[model samples]
Target: MQINQTQSDGLKQAFSVTLPFADLEQKRQARLVELGRTIRLPGFRPGKVPMSLLQKRYGSAVMAEVADESVNEATRQLLSERGLRPAMQPKVDLVSAGEDKDLEFTLELEVLPEIEVPNLGEITLTRLKAEPGDEAITQGLDNLLKSRRKEIEVTEERPAAQGDAVVVDFVGRIDGVAFEGGTAQDVPVELGGAGFIPGFAEGIDGISVGETRTIKVTFPAEYGSAELAGKDAEFEITAKGLKQFETPVADDALATELGFEDLEDLRKFIKDRLQRELDSEARQNIKRQLLDALADRISFAVPPSLSESEFTQIWNRLEEEKKAGRLDDADKDKDEDTLKAEYRAIADRRVRLGLLLAEIGQKNGITVSNEELNRAIFQHSMMYGARQQEALDMFRKNPQAAEFLRGPIFEEKVVDYVLELAKVEDKPVTAEELAAAVAADAEG
Candidate 1:
């Protein structure tokens, strides 16, 4: 057996591995002997099959297995001996496959770049802090009440207007042909709510109960359904009932209704919720700033394959958003080449940041604990409500999904570690100002 370096370049190495035919034959014989002890033939008992007969029955299959094992072992030995880590799976190509000749293959792979985590003490960050203001608390209370608001049918005979809710039966047809998902009965639509098609809610503005009207709207050119894109449709709508929302005042009674002891309790809950949201946003902003700072300070060549993989993921998401007509305003005016170029840069930055964070975490012995993982998974499962158990089961059952959670958890832990070491000065800012700062950071 021999391993020879064929080529060496930045982060990339190529090698030629050769195993003499005799060695391969020996390995094959050893594997066959290992399998023979348990072998059972039609006319022979277990461990009684003749070598010649076994060779005739399974020689080719055993040789294939031996070849794979040999290649894998050679590759593992090469990587281990060099103290190198591949950025991705190494590519192997068979150079010679004849049984009578030496077995040879070419191994090519990119190694991870060496990274030096910057001095934590040298990094200074300003962490934003905001308390939910009185107005925000009042607004939150109002929103909470509105979420529980009941609707009562209107007694007055009046035309449906903005903020008025109405139940209607409607059928939409494009070019005189009904389309799928174009009809609904007793569907509640709020006039001028902008929940339906562009002109749908406006068309209902003057409608009264028992009135019938035809509303026309054109599907956007970038609508999710290609078949309906840019097509004009007429909806024949019949108003069935009209109602108005009745929100209760945030008083003790309302608090009791919400299972809270008093209005003060509800206020405290709202304040706490708002504080959590603010803190989360602040943490996110700080993390983003830290990432940007690290990117500016660190310089290393990321594996092209890793960058390409990251770019593919970003591109896939962009394409999905574009298909759904939810492409961001920033991307709307950019040509394909421009968008690709910009996103590629983003991908490269992500790779660099990810690699740096991973290195820091490894050096500091940071890891995601099982308890933390379980807590994170539980929090994630909460998003599914009634199917939370199923969501939890999915993460527990799939290692990859668990790793997704683990990665973020590990990264956050490392970030927290870095924060503890760095000088993070809390700068108080109004909620508006903090929000604007975050927005500006996002834009830049």
Candidate 2:
């Protein structure tokens, strides 16, 4: 056996490997002997086949098997001897493999780049802190009460006004033809309230009971349904009745109705829940700052294969968004070349950061425990509601599906580990301010 380094560039390496025909013949002979021990030939007893006939019958098949094993073995030996970690599967090009000839192949692969873990203590980040105030709790309770508000039918004949609910039958047509999901009967629509197409609720603002009117509206450019987006449509609406909401007072009775012991208990629960949400947002903000700091401090060449894979995933998603007319505003004005360059840079950064985090986790012996992974899986399954058991069973049966959860858990743990070591200063702010900060970070 022999090996030669054919090429070396950045993170890519290629090698030529050759196995002498003598070694191939030896392996073939050994395999033939093993098969002979369990063989039964016509006109011969078991394990008594002649060596010449055995070779004649299985020589080609045995040699092919030997060639495959030799290539794999040689590749493994090459990687081990060279201390090379591949970024992806190595490409094998069989150069030569014929009877009584030396086996030869070329191995091409992009190796994982060496990553230098930065000093965690040197990284600086500010964690925004926010807590739900008494006013916030009161507002939350008010919102809850509104959700549970009852509608009282108006007895007197009158026109629907703002904050009033109106029952109506309507059919919408686009370009003079009715479309699917554009017609409904006896639907309760809240005047001046959300969840209606723009101008729809306002169009019915002055509609009186038993009145029929035709309202014209143009769907927003970013409407969810692509077919109706930016299209002008007319709705023929027939008002059925008028109703108003009976707003409930946020008192003990209301709390008990919502499954709480008392109003105070409900307020405490709301505050606690709000605090948890703020804490989650705060952690995310600080983690982003820490990652940005680390990315700035550390720099290394990422494997092109990894960057390309990440870019491909990002570009595919962008294409889907473009097709759905949901492309980001920032990217909408950019040409194909500009978008590709910008997203390619993002892909490179992601791969580089991923490698850095992995290196840090490896060096610090950070790992996700089985219990933590199970808890994460259980939480994920809970998202499926009644099908939670089915989701759990699927994860249990499909290791690959469950393995997808491992990366997030591991990355979070790594981030937590870094946070523990980094100098993270807590800055108290209002919930609105914290939200604005997060939004700003996301926009950049």
Candidate 3:
């Protein structure tokens, strides 16, 4: 066996491996001998197959099997002996393979780049902190109370207005022809809610009980119904009743109605929930900042193959979004080449950051435990609802599917490990300011 490095480039290499035919024949003969002991043939006793007969019958198959084993073994040894970690599966091209000729193949692959993680202790990050304000708490309580609101018939004779729920019966017609699902009876619509066709709810305003009006509306171009999309329709609506939200006062009774011990308990729960949300957001923001800073500091060549794979995934998703008409506004105007360039850069950054995080985790001996992975898988399975057991079964059966969950868990653990070591200073800000910062980061 011999290995020659034919090409050496940054994060990529090509190797020529040669294995003598004698080695291949030796392995094939050994395997065939082992098989002969368990052989069963018609008109012949078990373990009694002649060597000549066996070789004639299965010689080619055994040689092929042996050739595959030789290639895999040679590649494994080549990578291990040279300390080369491939970023992706190596491509092997068989140059020559015959009964008498030496088995020769070329192996080409992109190797994992050498990554130098930034010093965790020296990394500085600002952790944005926000506490729920009294106004926010009051508003949250108001919303909670409103969610429990009920409607009652309007006793005063007044026109329907915004925030009022009106019950109406209506028939819709397009081109003087009625369509399916265009009519309903005693439907309750909140004025100004915009839940129905454009101008339908607003047109209901200024109408009194028992008054009938014909409202015209044009469906949106992207409306779900293909037949009615961008088409004009008229609804003959009769206002049957008007109702307003009657919210309960925030009191002990209100809390009891929501299964809480008291109003203060409800407030505490809301505050805690809000605080958790703020804390989660702050941690996420800080993580992103840390990753961006880390990326900026590192100057290493990323494997083009890895970047290409990542770019392919991004481009595929973008194409899917375009097909679904959910493409981002900023991406919609860009030509394919421009979008590819932008996404390729993004892919490069992601690969570099991923490599850095992996290095950090490796250097610190950080790992995602089986229990943690199980928890992650269980959480992911919950998204399947009634088919959660089926999801679990799939994950258990498929190692690759389980790996999808492991990647994020490992990355998050690495992030948390860095955060623990990094110098993160808390900076208090208003909830609105924090939200603005997060939004800005997302847009940027």
Candidate 4:
């Protein structure tokens, strides 16, 4: 066997390999011998079958198998010898081969790029620190009380107020014909709540019980149903009843009703939960900031294959957002050229960061153990609820699925390890402030 290797680009390499006829003949002879040891065919006892007959019948099949294995083996050996780590699978092509000559093939692949992870000790980042605060907790408690609130029958025979809940039957039509989900009977509507279109809920206000009226509203331009989007519709409604919220007081009674012992205990539990939520958000914010900082410090030719993949992922997401009108106004402000340039830069950053993390992990011998993989599989399984065992079985049965699980786990571990080396400082801030910081980072 002969091997020749050369680089095509920063991360791409080409390998040409040739295997001698002697090796092919040896494999063919071995295959025939193995077949001779097996059971009888209809014409003769299998062990008594001649080697010439075995070669005549299975020679082509065996040769193809041997050729494939030979290419795969050579590719593996080349990677081992050169220490080249591919981002994805290596592509192999049969360069030249004949019935009884040298078997030849070429391998084309984008190897993982070499990266110098910089300034681990001097890199600065700040993790946002926050508690939900008194205002937020009070709002949360008020929400719970509101959830327990019921619609009490209105005593006064007067028009409905803005905050009043109305029980009504309504039939809405566009072009004088009803649409799906546009008709309902005895539905409860809280006036001024996030119900229906912009003016739909407000139109229900000031209607007294037993009144019948037509409420006209227009669907927004960005509505989900394309046919009905921006269309005007009139609803024929019969106001059956009017009611007001009867909220439960925050006391021991409310706690017992909520399956808790006392209001104080409930508040304490809620406060602790809220604190953890804020801290989780803070940690996530810091993680993104650190990634962005690391991206800024690095510049190298990302493996073109990975850059294309990253670009596709980001661009696909952007397309979805654009179609849904969910892209932020700031994003809309930029022209397509500008947006592409900015996002391309982002794709490059992500590819570079991925390369950096992988190189660092490899250099430090960071790897996911079998125990870690099993645990990850178990946790991922639990995400599917009662089918967890079935999902776990799937992971255990499929090597690729299990390997996919390792990538994220390893990535997170590497991020944590890098954070330890970086000069990350705690920055106490309000929820709004932290949100602003993230928003600003996103805008840039």
Which of candidates 2 and 3 is the stronger one according to lDDT?
2
In candidate 2, what are the lDDT values of residues 1-444, reduced to their tens digit?
799998999999999999999999999999999999998888988889989999999999999999999999999999998899999999999999999899999999999988778788988889899998888888988888888889999988778889999999999998889999999999999987899999999999978999999999999999877778899999999999899999999889988988999989999999999999999989888888988998898779989999999999999999999888888889989999999999999999999999988888999899888898899899999999999999999999997898899999999999999999999888899999999988998999
- The digit string of per-residue lDDT tens for model 3 on 1-444 reads 988889998788999999999999999999999989988978778789998989999998999999998999999999998999999999999999987889999999999988877677888999999999988888889878778888888989999988899999999999888889998999999987757878999898889999999989998866766567689999999999889877789999988888899999999989988899888888778988998888888988999988999999999998877776667768879998999999999999999999888988898899989999999999999999999999999999997899888899999999999889889899999999888888878887
Model 1 over residues 390-422: C-alpha lDDT tens digits? 999999789688778899889999899988888
| Model 2 deviation from the true structure expressed as Cα RMSD, one decimal place | 2.5
Top lDDT: which candidate number?
2
**N/CA/C clash count, model 2:** 0
lDDT ranking, high to low:
2, 1, 3, 4
Off by over 4 Å in 1: 42-50, 98-100, 159-163, 169-185, 191-207, 212-238
lDDT against the true structure, per candidate, is 0.90, 0.92, 0.89, 0.84
State TM-scores per candidate: 0.87, 0.91, 0.86, 0.86
Model 3 segments more than 4 A misplaced: 150-161, 167-187, 192-200, 208-249, 320-334
Angstrom error of the Cα, residue 111, model 3: value is 0.8
Residue-pair clashes per prediction, in order, are: 0, 0, 0, 1
